[model samples]
Target: MNAPLTSDASPRLEDFPYRISDNVRFADLDPNQHVNNAVYATYFETGRVTLVKDRSHGLMPEGLSWMLVRLDMHFRSELRWPGTIEMGLGLVKFGRTSVTLDQVVFSEDKCVASAQAVTVLIEEATRKPTRLTSEIVRNFQPWRRRGVNVASPKF
Candidate 1:
C-alpha cells in the first residue's frame, strides 16, 4: 500500500511532470453545491489516460494495455463549479508489471484533491499481466515526479 498525502504537507503542482486543464461542469456538482467525490476520480483518470494513451509519448506499446489495479484518493478542500481545474500526474515507482503514480487536481493554484494509483501492464490478447519492457520503462523517465528517487526499472 502507498502512504497517503498528509494535510500538513501537501504536494506542489510543479512536482508533477504531466499536467492538463479541465473545466468543472455544472453536472459534476452534487446537492451540496460542490464537485461530487466521484467526479474527482474522473479527473484523476483524465490525467493518467491522457499521458499513457498519447502515442507521441511512446508509453504504450502494441499488443499491450494498462489496467488500473488500485487508486487511493484524498480530498482536501471543496471544489466548486464555475472554475477550471489543473490536473497533474507523476510517476513515483516502477515495478516489474506495475507502475505507481501520484496524481493531483488543483483549482486556482490550490490542491483540492490528490491520489495514488497503480496500473499494471497486460497482454491485450491474453489479458494477463506482462512485465514492462525496457523501452517502455525508459520512455517513462521523463514523466517521473520531482524530488522522488524512482529507482531504475528492473527487467
Candidate 2:
C-alpha cells in the first residue's frame, strides 16, 4: 500500500498536510469542566478550515462548492478544561467528486477525539454534482490513500 500523501506527489506522514495549535477557551467547557461534544466538532472543523485556507483551498471553490455528505466522530478521551489542544488534519481521500477530511484533536500528549467527513463537489450555479477536475484531483492526489484512488465519479 502506498503511504498517505504529504503532498500531491509524495506519500509520507512527514509531509503531513497541516497542523494547528489552539487552546480551549472558557466558553468551550461545559459545567462538568470538560469540553463539550459540539465543541469538539467545531474544533475539528476549525483545524480543517485553517489548513485549507492557509494552504490555498478556499472555503468554496470557484464554479464549484462542496457539500457535506457524511461525518463520523470517535471520542477517545476527555479533554479537561485549562489546557491547550492541537488539532491535526489530513486529506485522507480525494475522490472524483468528493474529498474525505480526517481530523484528530490532541490535548497536549493525549488524543481526545478523531473525526472523518466526506464532502461532495457540486456546480455552484446549478447545485448539481459534477466531475472533479484534474486540477482539483491533482491538488489532493499527492495525499491520496495508499490503496485507494479517490478519483471516481459519484452522483
Candidate 3:
C-alpha cells in the first residue's frame, strides 16, 4: 500500500517570477498612520503593468491595451509607511478576450493584501474585447494557474 500525498502542488504567489517593488509614502498613509486602502489598488496596477511591459514574456502584442473590468480584493493587514511593498503577480485565469490575474502585496515580509482582477484586451478602434492570439496563449501557458485546466468563461 502507498501513502497518500501530503503536499499540494498548487501554484502560489511565490510561483510567479514577476516581481514589483514600491516604497510606501507618507502621503499614502491615512489618519491611522498606515497605508490607505485605496493605495492597494495602485500597487496591484503597478504589478500588472510591469508584468505586461517591463517584464513581459514576449507573448503580448507590442501595442496591446487592456481594459480592467473588475477587481475583487481582500485586505489582510495594515501596511505601514516608509516600507517597501513587494508584489507578486500570476495568471489565474485566461479567456478568449480577457485574463484574470491574482496578486499579493507584501510589506516587511508580510502579506498585506491580495486581489484578483479581470482585464480585457481591447481593440483601440472599436474599444471592444478582442480574442487572444495563439502566440500569446502559447506564451502564457507556462504561467497558467496550476490546478486550472480551462480558460475562464467570463470576462
Give the winner by lDDT. 1
* Candidate 2 similarity to native, TM-score: 0.75
lDDT, candidate 1, equals 0.93
TM-scores for all candidates: the values are 0.95, 0.75, 0.81
Please write out the lDDT profile of model 3 over residues 4-86, one tens digit for every residue. 53222332556655678888889999999998899889989998887766435765576677788998777888988788888
Find the number of clashing residue pairs for candidate 1.
0
Where in model 2 is the C-alpha error above 4 Å?
Answer: 1-16, 54-60, 142-155
**Pick by TM-score: which candidate is best?**
1
> Positional deviation of 98 in candidate 3, in angstroms?
0.7
Residue-wise C-alpha lDDT for candidate 1, range 35-87, written one tens digit per residue: 99999999999999999999999888999899999998989999999999999
Better of 1 and 3 by TM-score: 1
The runs of at least 3 residues in candidate 3 whose Cα sits more than 4 Å from the true structure, single-residue gaps closed, are 1-12, 145-155
